[model samples]
Structure formats: C-alpha cells, structure tokens
Target chain A: MSEYTPLSEVGEFGLIRLINEKIELRNSSTIKGIGDDAAVLEPGEKQIVVSSDMLLEGVHFDLTFCPLKHLGYKAVAVNVSDIAAMNAKPTQITVNIALGARYTVEAVEELYEGIRLACENYKVDLVGGDTTSSHGGLVLSVTAIGEVAKGESVLRSGAKVNDLICVTGDLGAAYMGLQILEREKQAFMANPDMQPELEGKQYIVGRQLRPEARMDVVYDLKERGIKPTAMIDISDGLASELFHICKQSGVGATVYKDNLPADEQMLQTALDFNIDPLTCIMNGGEDYELLFTVPLSDHEKLKNHPDISIIGVITEESEGINLATKHGNSYPLKAQGWSHF
Target chain B: MSEYTPLSEVGEFGLIRLINEKIELRNSSTIKGIGDDAAVLEPGEKQIVVSSDMLLEGVHFDLTFCPLKHLGYKAVAVNVSDIAAMNAKPTQITVNIALGARYTVEAVEELYEGIRLACENYKVDLVGGDTTSSHGGLVLSVTAIGEVAKGESVLRSGAKVNDLICVTGDLGAAYMGLQILEREKQAFMANPDMQPELEGKQYIVGRQLRPEARMDVVYDLKERGIKPTAMIDISDGLASELFHICKQSGVGATVYKDNLPADEQMLQTALDFNIDPLTCIMNGGEDYELLFTVPLSDHEKLKNHPDISIIGVITEESEGINLATKHGNSYPLKAQGWSHF
Candidate 1:
C-alpha cells in the first residue's frame, strides 16, 4: 500500500513536483512546460489558433451521470472542437483544474488518464497547466492551440453567397443523451432500487459523455482537396451555429427542414422528453459536430460523403436567414444557443 | 430601479449579448473575438508568451476582505506578472469567469470596471473570454499574451556559476499584509461592532490586496541594456523561486542573510504576529517582485539602482543552496511555499 500524505504535508512545490514528475514533453514546438514561468511553443511559419473553455461541475455535468475520466476527456475534446472549427490541426493543450478536498490522488490520475487518451488519439501534446484546490466543486479550464498555414485557416466570416452549407454527422444526439441521463438520475433518486433504463441508449450516452470532435472531417476535406469557405462546430445546436456563420460572414441561408440530420434514437428520445424533434435538432447544444460552407462548385465532391449532409446554401444578406419547412413555409431562423451566464 | 432577469429566463444568447455588448477590440492583432469559434492573434515576427492562472473565491481571496473591484484588478495583475517575468510586454488577455447565482449585474460590472482599469493601466487589450455560471462561489481564469523579440526573452535556466543574483524592491510584505487582514477579519467576526485596526498597516495591506507586478523593473532592465541571464517572479516566495532557478540552471546559490531586503513595516508586522522577520522575508510568498541573475560585471551598473538588491551569487552545483545567517552559520535552504492544495 502507498503512503497517504496529505497535500498539506508537502505544500505547493511538493505537490507540483508530484504531479509534474511523470509529464514528458513529446512535441518539437513545446520548448518548455511546468518548470518555467509559462510553457513556450514555437509555431514555425504557421498561424496559431487558441481556444479556451471552462467547465463547472454542477452546471456542465452531473457527477451522478458523468464519470471523472469522461469529464476530463470531454473538456479536452470540446476545446479541440473549437480549433477544428477553424479547419486547423490541434497540436497542444494546457489544462487548469481546480479540485476540491474530496478528490484523492487516484481520482486525479483517472482524470489525467482520459486526458492522456484524448491527447494520444488527437496527436496533441499536453504542454502545461496550473492545478490548485477549489473551495467547492471541480472546475476544468482547457486552452487548446492549433496551427494552420498563414492564410489557410477557415474563419466564421469567410462564408459567401452561393456557398454550399454542410454539416458533418447527425445532430440532436448529445442533447437526447443528456435527457436520458437526467431521466435516469431522477428515476434513481426517486427509487434507489430501480435499475437504470440505459440498456439501449449506449450510443446517445456515449455521445453526451465523450463526444468526439470531427477531426476526421477535417482530414477528409484535405484528402478530397476541398477547402471550406467558413466553418464552425455545432456545439450550440445547428440553427444557432448557422446564424453565427451568416451574421459573421454577412450572408443569409436557408436550411431545408428535412436535411437537418438526426438519428432515429435522437428523435425518439426528444419525443420522450416532450421536446419537438425539430426544435431539438435546431437548438440542442453540445453535439460537437462540424458545420462548414464550401463553394457550390465543390458540391459534387462532397455530395456523396456518407457522414456529411449538404444542409443548405448561403444567400445575399437581404434575403435573411430562414428555415424551409417540409410544408413549404419559410420562417426566419432565430438562434437559441446555450448560455452559461 | 434596475431590472433583474434570471439567467435561465434570458437564456444563453441573451446573456452573451448582455456581457459582450460593450466590448470593442482595440488591437489590430485581435483578428477575432467573441463571435468567432476561436480568437485569432497575429503576433507578427514576435514570439508570444502565454500564461494562465485560475483564482477561486475563498481559496485565493475572501469576499469579506477583498472588494470585487480589487479582486478583479489583482487577478489581471497576477497574470500580467507571469508575462513580465519572461521579460515580455503584455499585449492582450482573455478572462473567463464563472459566477454563482448570488451575483448581481452591478457586481459583475464592478468586477469588469477593475478589469478595465487594469487594461488601461497596462495598455493590454481585453481580447476574448467566456462568462459562465458556477454552482458555488466565483472563479476567474485569465490567460495573458505577451510579446518579446527573438533572443530578448529570459528563462530560468540561463544562470551560470558566479553570476550575481539580484532581487527587486522588498519581499514578505504581501504575506504580512495577509496576516493583518486575517487577524482583522477574525476580530470583526468575534465582535461585529469592532472597528478594524487598520490605521498604520496601510503599506502591508496594500501590498497584499493590490500588489503590482514588477513591469517597471522589466522596462528598466531594457533601458539599462542589461538582460538577465535567468529570471523568475517572487510569487511563491524568494526561496522557492531561487530553488527553481538553481535546479533549472544546474547551479546552487549562496544568499547572504544581511543582504535580504525587507520593508520596515513588514518587519514590525511580523513581530506583532509573533513570526520571525527573517523567516517571513525568506519564505513568505506573493510579493510579485522580480528575482534574477546577471553577470558579475553588470553588478556595478545596477549597484546604485534604488530598487535592486544584490543578495547573492551563483555557486557550483556540488555546493548546494545555502543561506548564510548574519551570525555566521550557514543553513541548507528549504522551500515552504504557499499551498492552495
């Protein structure tokens, strides 16, 4: 058995040494890590992209339904998704975690294990971070760094009229997954002996707990020799992200109601939660899917891509953003994105 | 009377609009901010220095003793200190804050007011950040970006044997200030009607509540044509930082106890608190002063500098770190740095 030395015993330096003892730098750009005043990165000849996200314990995730390991993975993945939205490759990340006294060394190790796994999968290096104690719940803040050629990065403002709007993978699944987890939590709270009804909801649950950013879509676009005009991640639902692209790019869009992709399980889950399936597809957040705009001439190349859906096309700003319904009515789109404040 | 809207009522988009409504980008390097998937910076031909710090409410500051405005100012100041330690000039910062339900709009404005003041004082742009709700107390995470020309930035691993070690201004005053604040807090808690005994403790109190980062020292060093061989800020304590420099530079140090700098008020305050003055000067943290090493030839140049104290010289690695007492006994130095964990 290992000795149980309280953090108070060694103070901050001792704790820093204990935590940083196992960290080995792997990237050439990482000139420094935990020992210096700040981690140094040399992003030679490439424009670096920086994204930061903060996750709170009770607001972002419930400990009852989310494992610490998955929480750590999701934190890194969501930040990486922001970089992926720029069509850049994630290269390094700094993770700052605030843990309460309730957590043990073993628990922190489990969290870092998930972080390590995500880093390995994404080929990103864990460069540096600050770790401290929290007065209450856990807080994880991740800053991800990515790189693209000087003029090659896809920005939200780059979309133009006639660009083909595209979305990768199905939406509304992560929101549906959250609903299932909340229902199970409520059920378990009401009746402790009741078994969780989670047998068939594994896919949605996994999406909620450990959603992967579509780096694969980034690679595929490169392989097909097509550069998107603009891109963003659908973390705050399809409709909200579409509005962002339109507003920033000074363009308008009309998304076909039927082309808003959703898995069958997602639809059923939304129905069970008394939420409109269409509304869930439009406004459900945390999907971690990529939304991009490609030139109309490149449509043929991506038209048959299995995981991608050609949802709409951009229009002149005077036309206004709209949703073309199955019943042939066009309604102006409104963003109902996720807000933490 | 002002209106009060529940965050859930306004939802996320409305909150984003409320927070970002007044923010305007002042720097050309800020290619994108809140509207984009990720903030982009164009650090043209300059190496960028990035540092992150997380401040929890009770762990880092008590609401009773710290006004929200000072807390905000201190938060930005501390992050700027990290960049200053690298011999770089801060250009932009991103602040992420998570607040509990009890916070009001006015309170947030107060916090932002202090942040704005710091930005103006430091000439740093408030580029981008996330504002979110927390489950418990307040948390602020600030990431500072700074610029340094190639080969101009200093690191902690450049000190050589026989190099003279220099420290700016005084040490231990902040720690003493904290002690007085705590004592007053306890006294006020025990007797609600008691007036705080804060008349003569202004210097130490200010040191603790609003410690300024040694940006002036960095600028002075540049003006004097003196580049430190190695440098670090006295955030964790003098001894802790010295230990870091020695370990990284592969050299030891011998600091003269008589050369240790301590403010008169700090010495008196330590005596009043029944703590050793020399002990406080050596191990007390959060001074926000600069500790550096320079070639012995440069010592004469800085000998007349008012703010600098040449406390020691680098020693061979086999000698180990030592502190020579005024009475002639040498003791092996130890780091009892502040512990948040």
Candidate 2:
C-alpha cells in the first residue's frame, strides 16, 4: 500500500522503537522491557532457566523460499522450545538481529511482525535487545528466560528403569517438508517458469517453515498431574534425543518403529523423494516436539492422551538403545544429527 | 608448541565440550550451567537484568590487527558494560558464535581463552550458548544476565534539573587508538619491510583493541554511597549519549569542553593525525566509559573520587543541550554519533 523505506532512513534507534512499539508485556515478572540498558525481571519464587540460540543466514535458513515473517517466528519458537524442554514456562526473551545494507526497514518490520506474533502466542515478554549492522546476511540471536518451580524441573538425567518414553505429535513431517521445499527450489532454479507442485502438501510444508514449540503439551502434562521423569525437545531428531536421555540418565531405551507417529503427507512425500520414511522419523531435525519420559506408575494418567505417543521404554544401562521393527527385528539406534559446522 | 587442530576434526560437539571444560560457576544462584537445554539460576531475593549484543565481522571488527582473544574478551566486556550501566552486578553470560570453515579448533580455543579470562575476572559464570557455522565471517553474540536489589537499578530517564553529570575514566583514547591502527595498516600495506612504530602507542592502541567496561565505577559509586540518578555507557561518544539521556529524561544540560578528560597518548596521537582532540572526545565512539548523573546533594561525596569527573550540570528542559567552549562562547551540541549503517 505504501512505498518501502530504506533501513538507513529509520536508523538503529528508530528500528528498535518500531520493534518495541506493539510489544505488550504479558509476563508480570518483567519489571522493565526494551527501553533501558537491560530488561529487568523479578523471579519471585521460581527458579530461572536461560537459553540462547543463534541462526545464521545460509547456515540455518534459505531466504529464497522462507518468508521473513516465518523466519522470525521460527527463530523465537526454536529458542522457546529450549526453555520448554527444561519443563519451564518461558517468561521473557531478548532478541538481537544483524542486517545487511541490502535489507530495507520494511523487510525488518516484516521479520518483527512474525516475532511479535510468536511472542503473543507464547505469552513471553519482549525485553532488551541490540540491533546492529551485518556485512553478510541476516543473523538472529535470541536468549529466552523462563521459570520453573524449584525441584520440580525435569532434567535429561532423571529417567530410570521402567520409565515410559513419550514423544509429542508426529515426527519426520518437517524433514519431509524440507525435502519438498528443496525439490521445488531445484525445479525452480532449473527454469524460473516452473510452478511448484505443492498441492496437498500443506501439512508437511507448514511444518518445515513454521514449526510450533510443544508448550501446549507442557501445559497438558501439568494439568493431568503427570510429571515426566526426564525431558528433551526433539530438535535434533528423535534418535539423537533418545541418545541424550539415555546417556544423561545412564540408561538404555527400546523404541518400536510402529509407535513412531508420522503424518500421512510426510510418508507420501518421503516416497516421492525416494527416501525411507523411517529414516526421516529417526534422523530428521527441526521438529521442535517434546520427547520426554514418565514413571511407570503415572502411565495410566498419560496413556489416553490423543497426541502423546508412548514410543518407547527406558531399559537397563547394559541393554543399549535400540529400535524394534514392526517385523520383530531389533537394531541399535545411531544419532546422525545435523552438523551445522 | 603443539600443532593447531582443525575445527572439522573436533566437530561441533567436541568443540562445545572443549569450551565448557574449564568454566567454574562463581554465583551460587547458578544451579546449573552449560550442559542441559538451558542454564538454571535461582535469584532468591534479587531482580534480574538481561542484555544482549551482537558483533559482526568487518562491520564491528577487523581481524587483520584485532586479535581473536581480544575480540572474545571485548565481546563479553561490552555486554557486561550494559549490565553495569543498569548498576547491576553481572552473574552469567551465554555466548553464541558462528565461525566460518577457515577457523581451526585452536582458533576457537584462542577466542575462548579470552572469554574464559574475562569470565574469571568478572566473576560471572559461563552458562550456555550456541556455536554453529556462518558462511561469512565470524559472528559473536553475547547475552549477559545480572541482578540488583529491587528498585536500586539506575535508568537513563531519571535525570532532574541541576543533576551533576559525571563520567568515569578518560575519553577519546579509544578513537585515537583506532586511528593509530588504521594508519599502521596503511603504512604496512605500502611498505611490507617496515615495522610498526607501536613503542609508545601501546596505551592508545590497547584502548581501541581491548576497551574495558566500567564496572569498577559502579562498585566505586556503591562504596561511596552515591547512586547515579541516571546513567548510560559511552559507546557512541559523549554528545550522543548525552542526547539519549536528555531526550529520555526530558531535561537539558550544559557541558564544559575544558572539563573533558583526554589521555596523554590520545592527545598527542590526535595532533599527529592533524585531528582536533576535542572533536575526538565529543564525537568518537567505542570508549565504553560510563556517563552518569548524580543528585547535587551527593556531589560532595562523589567529587573526590579518583576516576570520577564531574564534567557538567543539568539545566531546565527549556535550556537545550549545549557545549560551553574554553572561551566564553557556548554553542548547541550536535550528536553526530557513529552510523553503522
């Protein structure tokens, strides 16, 4: 509707003000936000948890297909996911972004639009941040601060023998989504006139571009009075997360292939890409789902949940982490996670 | 000496473990650091302060003369300076870095060496961070967490008429040091055989390469029982920071040019470059000095401090910010701060 304004016209201070203008503090513990040298908070009776994540341009995302708004929302969601993994409710986040001269003020505003939306969705306060220039592409770094009740926070090292290993929602959808996007990108590069064949692929495509953090499941578990024995977010694939839980807890796991949830579109897309859907479920990253464990005694409380899938069970340390096929063969799981470096 | 190790040889996980090995938690509030999904802290009775900063290669630093270790140390110091600007004690920091493929494991370790040194010196714990790959140059983003007694944090919007404006340490040296470095770089390019004439220029050079945050001033003010009514760090020079305080506080001020502090090396280097030292003091950036305002009543207590200098007095809102010359003439001050864009 209007002409775009260059970032140089708005300057750093103006950009910061624009980013903070619509940010309403959702967390009461946030005493001050985004004006002074730092954000002030008073964590009255809760223990605080802090986590940070950095996303580079080419290293983390490709701007050719990823919308700036989705990129912004994904950045915040991923950091909030880390806080959720700690069984803590995220309260505040400080976001820092570096932009190249090629970016306009409108482009930055588009990115912040997604950030604001995610902040509202998560009910986290937008706190202090620094906006600086970058010589390369866009860089977003977010530090999330959350709080959990003392001694109630679930850790990766707390799983014990007979603990039920659970995962939230479906796995491999985002991985398939990435595959679809990559294939479309290749097709588009081969010829600029080719239309993307994305019909009926919305379920998997959305998972890749706009993955939601499993905070809803965290709330669900609390409401049902089911405390997980151990927890971790499924960012680095299901198999790698299983290794984290097993290694930290000094235990082993046995996950059944049939129990791993997969979206129908994800399976179809995996076949289209000539890849095994099982491999996608185990090794595909960027799911942002919760993979946690519960004590056997609390199994009755969690067994009937619609979205929660009891994928596996914790075993003795000597048993080793393995995946049992539907046909009765068992194989040790390997964590071939993403190596960004 | 041992040969340098390639970063690829160590991979991301090994590099993380290498960096986390020597970190010791100094704050009792840090329940957990650098292992799980997030760092855990329990700030029992204090309010928390959070700040973040991002430094991009070529945009914020030059590696030709800037040592990686100093870069690492300066990155932490600059973020900690923001916490100190709020009159809060820094407790923990999460450092996120993106290194290119050219970097070796030893290079990352060198950078961490400075970070470790700063963490030890500042008594802040290295909590958690994300280290990945960047397609361009290095990127370092640090988020510092600090704490203060409730209602004791200083802000930039609290200055009143007649508040004594003060600054810690000498100014203009950092700007001059940058000038020296740039000059030497040009000379070296012209004559590869010539040695850098850095014998007496070490003070000014060090000021530019490794500026220290003024946490000592915060401690000094507390010990002297004088709290600044308003405060800001001099990252973008004196006049710009003065404008920020005045605009935010809804007040005006007058500063005397003669009262500005200049290091001996800085003054000489400025003249050698044929640039006026007064201009460097007023408009030069990246000094990392603390500029603050104190109530007139506490002037008697703070006036005798060794590093603290009372440079000016705040005036009524109608009186506009002005700079009084060494002569009887006064002129309106313009804040031509650094424009990174």
Highest DockQ, which number? 2
DockQ for each of the predicted structures, in order? 0.62, 0.86
TM-score of each: 0.94, 0.98
- lDDT tens per residue, model 2, A315-339: 9999999999889999999998887
Write down the lDDT that model 2 would get: 0.92
Cα misplacement distance, residue B324 of candidate 1 (Å)? 1.3
- lDDT agreement with native, every candidate: 0.86, 0.92
RMSD in Å for all candidates: 2.3, 1.4
- For model 1 chain A, give the 10-residue run with minimal summed lDDT: A2-11
